[model samples]
Target: MSTQVAPTSGSPSRMAQLRQVFFSSPIVAFASLMLLLIVLAAIFAPWVSPYDPTRLAPATRLKPPSELNWLGTDAFGRDLFSRVVYGARISLVVGVGAAVAAVLLGLAVGLIAGFFRALDAILMRVVDGLMAIPNILLAIAIVALSGASLWTVLIAITIPEVPRVVRLVRSVVLSAREEPYVEAAMAAGSSTWRILTRHLLPNTVAPLIVQGTYICASAILIEAILSFLGAGISPETPTWGNIMAEGRIYFQINPGIIFWPGLVLSVTILSINLVGDAVRDALDPRMAKRGIDR
Candidate 1:
């Protein structure tokens, strides 16, 4: 006679699993660290920056990197290091804010479209029309019409992002809505809202989270592009793109002006992209299991 052994639970807590996945790959760990440092620098810019980001010193114009000014001064004689530090705040705000707005709006549209056959055709046609337009072109048109400002730029960027998110969520919901549990919930006299929230919405979270990171990264890049093209926030605002735009004029004289901010922007985007990849892998059961088996 053989004695039966009870199966032990091996599943890890969410936080623990996330931590493990973050450190599983060295690139992911490094990216996360770099991203964290940039965020911290942005948050403490007012206190930690050596000089005022916007304050001009005509006497110090075009100065190179030195002990007095670590990253040197721009054409306006404002500290390059300080401007770059402060610029992080704008990038993060736009990226996060636009992504959140897009996701929430998309989620609502997607839920409605996926759940109801009548609305699906109408909503999908609208989504398709939006998708047909080039994202940057649409954003540029909106900004041009609305006049350039941070909020306008944010709205412009978000509008283009909504279609992609809506498509993703609608697909997920369409698939989930047909599942036995969801059908059972519907058949049991559950309200449409109740079935959506309880049965369909939860199924969309993982993919939405992954999609959100990509949206955030894309939003940051789009904001920078708009600013560079003079269609973003005010020129007076010391954003990364504005810094580069200002620096381009004096490119021959001092490349550091563009180099430093460009470097920061590139790294920040890369970090966000890397984190998104890690999150995708972590949230996917098949990917997680494959990683463990390997």
Candidate 2:
């Protein structure tokens, strides 16, 4: 009798694992859906928005929400809804850009500092000094010196974030470098570059993914704060913070002016944070061992 070969093991695939982690948690699922919708709205802002975000109509200025003007008009009669839709683009861009830049720069600096004992002291002292100053203060200083704009704001946000990423990466590398596989590779006369990239780098990926989400959420909040304080992009740009700042004076007249943007901003930030938390838990080895839903 012919018999089929038995499988060596039965384990869920990567995609199955992802689905289980993301979809099994009600809060995470809801948050992910909200975030996805916001991103889609931002990407299709031109089509999704009913009116030009910058269009002016003094007659329609400060008009309440209605069929014609869904989210109502600002002081300039620019459609608040449109401006908010566009604002998502600005916020997400800054958050993602700052996180990516910080991570890349931090990874390089961290790898070098961690691997080379001679440079660790010099690099970490600088990181410590940067970390000593508050994040917002450092961001503000950088923005002031560079002059406020998207690029400058990104740089401002990125500079302060880098130290944290660098420290995390450095610690990971320090521990990983001591592993037997690394030592074995070193003994085998592997190039430093190969040893670092092939071995040490892989070890940092899980932590970095989790760290990156936190950085993204933090960056989004910081960008909003900067814009609200008039230290961000130009006032003409319709970021959520700028929208709220412009409407603050007339809040009593129509709370929706500030209300709508503030709500969206809060939702966006909250969603990002929730997603980050879910990701962290899912990626935690201890949690994985315990099984997610349990």
Candidate 3:
């Protein structure tokens, strides 16, 4: 007689499988929490900031941290704490916004290129040309011609980022296109767009998401470099990069000027990397063996 195996709690039902994957991994949970908190702070910065980041106090100039001014005052006596809080909004917005724009554009180009060999060859050649140039230099050149504004910085950083994403997506799509199910779908006369959208895109998420983190990190760094060299956002705005630029002069006198903002920026980037690493680990097929099997 044939015997049937019972479906235990660990059986691979989709929801149970997901719970096993996400919740069982403490690293993923912790990283997710950290990311959520940072995003929340960025979203609520305007409301949460105690004082106006720009409003100056000549009397309280360069004062150390106190109850009134938690991170103390800048050279212009603007509240450093408030500025840091508000700065999160700008940094996160520019970093993530530029990444999203780049990735979406890249995904479209990559999808077309991967599905059609002729398109792939043409687009990849353009991508290769872009890649041959140093990305920072390319961004600087773009910003120089475009003129510096928030949107200009966004576009400049985005240009180089798109090509990288395009290459990544194209490679993933090429591999996924050869899968058995995709072949079956093709043989069944599924439309090209339908096969790409339904089969290829979903499989591409893991690597795309991991790469996206690096893109955000690079975008933020580029913004900082651009602003430092006077090619990014307007100096009047209190971005971290501008703050660092201003702090350079006062480095000898107070040092705190650059200290806090730089620290915050470093921590934010590190946290993002940590979160990215955790996501990569969770998504790795090899790690699933040690993880709760559902």
Candidate 4:
């Protein structure tokens, strides 16, 4: 005969569950710490930066990392460290702004398409058309048409991401709408709005959240690419992309110019991806069940 384990008050609280999920994967913990430090550095840039990122000094131009200038001065003699810090602000803003916009728009489209069978084909066809175009190329076209600026770049990045998000949400909603609870609500004469909002929307949150993190990470990388290609924010702006663009000319002279900012960007993206993976594993019921079994 087998003995059964009893549920008890010792079971973890919501916060404890989240903590455990975050720490269950060592990569997630390290990534979280790295992201936290980067965010803090970005937030405190104005105070922590030794010098103005954009203020140029010809006398100090091309200076290597030194006591006076931590990451050294760029070709324009602007502080590399300061520029990287300020660039973080731009990247994070674009990433988060684009992700939020895409998720909101995608959720609406997905809900309508998935809930109403009549609209599914047409809506999904449109989503398919959008997805057919390469993401970066679409963003470039949008940015080219709109003219490059912070907002334009954000919109450009967001538009390309929406289709992917919509597909993800639509698939989830399609499966969820057939569930017993959803059918029960439908048979009980629940209003379409109530059924969609009360039942369908809640189920999409976990996957949408996971997708959003990935979108945020993608947006950041896309923004950098756009800026580097001269299709992003103004060159005068001290974004990581523009900084690297400027640094490329002097790479033979001082590789540090490109190295530092590139390192930060890579680290930031990696950290976000790590956290996204952790969140996906945590929110997935199969994964959680497996963990419990283990």
Candidate 5:
């Protein structure tokens, strides 16, 4: 009789394996901490904000960081501290919302294109056209033509992101469709939709999630740029970009005005990208092996 043995995953537990990989790097830990703090700040905005974000005190305009206003007042005498706290809410919402929309749109197009040879040409051509334009330029053009509102910015960012997501998903799906399980599903007469949702979609999620983090970061940066250029949410809304825009004029007089918000945005984007890198390493066994304790 032949002896049988269970396969070894090289670690005692899945959690232990992941810890060895994801938490193995100090950069990953730092990124996680930075992102966690931003999330907490966004969540606690109402409670954390010191003053009415909307209320203006003309006399306090451009005040430097004093005890009364931890971050000082903006050009409008609006509490900079309060506005920065509220800005987190706007940035997070736009980032998450645009990424979700882009991912969903991309998944649908990619799944269909990958599954059907006849659809591939049409879809790929469309993706190519979108990709031909510089992403930020495309977003700026779309927002400029559509008019600058919150929804408009979301739509603009989402539009450019869709093509990239679609191309990535399509490649993954093309490979996935050739696998044994997919063939088995086809042999079983599973509908295309069923196979896609039950098999391909779930399999695609890990990569998509990792991609989504970068999308969120990109969306935030795009929103800031658009708002800075006067094409995003209204200035009254207190987005990070708008804050930076306001600070530009008073930069020499009150450099702190730009410093705090700009710092917050840069750190937030870096944290998100770092989290993305960590997640990619966590999800890919090849990457995990290289970066982790064997």
Candidate 6:
């Protein structure tokens, strides 16, 4: 006779459990709210920004914060507030793009490396080599060779992160491959791809979600660093890093030039990281047992 399993909770729905956990954690709640605001601002930059981010007004250069200028003007007399808002959009695009691409590539490689004993040594050696090199140096070399563009920057960021995701997924696959269900699937004439996809893939999803948030945060910081070094997006662009780079020369005239954009960049990264932490706690079985997370 067949049997069915009941839900984990008799009263609270899964969404309710998650909501309870969210409201109970003040730091996570605040971080989530901040992340939401930053995302919304980035998405609505065209409507939210008062001036063309790239438009220059030479006469008003280095203007201080005011009712008219909002966050004030930069060295080039472009609107700082407008540039910051628009910058968020591009920064997020790079962050999310790198996270997704890295995860996909890593998932494929990690599955093969973990499942097939013959390929493990070769794949791991390549991954270890990539990990041995400093990510920033590797990224800079790529940007220098490829020339700066959105696509190039995305590729540079994604390459450095792939090893991390690959390691995470590979470990999960290795452990899961020994499970009874997986062994049974193999014995029952399941294809290697079928066993990997149907049995192993589900185990990685929760961890991948947590890891993706961290990758997004790291990519944002790396992009900013590259831009600050004049190796990322064009100087003409209004990314937070580019803004700070341009203002460094005239910092005495207006510290606000760099300060405001830097603040926004820092807050966005902090929010993403905190959210990732919250997700990790939520997905952990121990935390779930205590009703501390979903």
What TM-score does model 3 achieve against the real structure? 0.88
C-alpha-based local distance difference test score of model 6? 0.91
TM-score of 4: 0.94
Candidate ranking (lDDT, best to worst): 1, 6, 4, 2, 5, 3
**Poorly placed runs, candidate 2 (over 4 Å):** 1-13
Give lDDT tens digits, candidate 6, residues 1-74.
99998875545554665676667889889988998999999999999999999998999999999998999999
Q: Where is model 6 poorest over a 10-residue stretch in terms of lDDT? A: 8-17
- What is the C-alpha local distance difference test score of candidate 5? 0.87
Clashing pairs in 1: none
lDDT of each: 0.92, 0.89, 0.82, 0.90, 0.87, 0.91
Per-residue lDDT over 1-294 for candidate 5, one digit per residue giving the tens place of the 0 to 100 score: 999898785634445655765577788788888888888988999888889889989998999888999988888899888888889988999999999999999999999998899999998999999999987798888887888888888998899999989998999999999999999999999998899999899778888988999999999999998888887888889889999998999999888778998999999999999888767767776765565542
TM-score of each candidate structure, all chains considered together: 0.95, 0.95, 0.88, 0.94, 0.91, 0.96
Order of the predicted models by TM-score, top scorer first: 6, 1, 2, 4, 5, 3
Q: Give candidate 4 regions above 4 Å deviation.
A: 1-14, 292-294
Model with the higher lDDT, candidate 2 or 4: 4
Q: Cα RMSDs of all predictions?
A: 3.7, 3.7, 4.0, 4.2, 3.1, 1.6
Q: Which ten residues in a row have the lowest lDDT in candidate 2?
A: 7-16
Query: Against the hidden true structure, what lDDT does model 1 obtain?
Result: 0.92
Model 1: how large is the Cα RMSD against the reference? 3.7
